[model samples]
Target: MTRRNIEGSFHLSGGDFTNAGAASSELKSILTNLGINPEIVRRAAIATFEAEMNVIIHAVAGVMYYLITQDTIKVVLNDMGPGIPDIDRAMTEGYSTAPDWIREMGWGAGMGLPNMKKNSDRFKLDSVVGEGTTVEIIIRIKEGKTE
Candidate 1:
């Protein structure tokens, strides 16, 4: 037997809507192959997708790093861009700073942060107004959920 762990990282470029959600989709596939619970996978996918989109919509570049285990899926998104000025307002489901063009494409509906928090068992968001933002999402897998 060899030693291994389920982990991966992906990079994203700002305004690259063409590749949005790719990383999250890969995560879903990995978790499915590992026999993790579908529900957990779904939540992780949604949360990660939202986080990924956030970086694409607002940052110059970003990376998503994830670690999976028998008990949890942990995802961290780090980006370089104009950080949130008001986390509270940003967390509101209907408030978005996304430009009109993004909304015209049917995104930036202001649900990203809210939805991310909703699907994560643990959520942490930090930002510097002019620096960047970092988000961590952790989802717990029940005892029998991992095979």
Candidate 2:
């Protein structure tokens, strides 16, 4: 965008697989229209989708906040659900806490967090056992040509 930065938010509901990827798709369209680099857009899209899916699968409810600037794309997904008790274990690639029903539906293979981290230039995740989880992912635009 021409402005200094753009901000937006998306609401999410757990177990609502019908509209799970809507937020990320909308974000992708926005970035594409804004003329962001393809590589940067791809990374942001991957991270954003992963974060959105995490909330949909694990949280009772949540919101994803995004900030787009000339230098970076940042998205923070905050969920109100059973918080993760082990951040380190959750970060592992092949680990998942998704229920059998979810797995039967072809999700929760345990790559969500890892994919988010891999696609992010910067990533931070925080959770409280009974509170919720907050994941922040930042994808840096190229140093130049980011108007």
The local distance difference test score of model 2 is 0.91
lDDT of residue 88 for candidate 2? 93
Best by TM-score: 2
Where does candidate 1 stray beyond 4 Å?
A: 1-4, 143-147
lDDT of every predicted structure (CA atoms): 0.91, 0.91
Candidate 2: where is the Cα deviation over 4 Å? 144-147
Q: Give the local distance difference test score of model 1.
A: 0.91
Compared with the true structure, what per-residue lDDT tens digits does model 2 show for residues 1-147? 356788999999998999999999999999998898888898899999989988999899999999988788989999998999989999999899999888898878999999999999889999998899999998888665432
Clashing pairs in 1: none
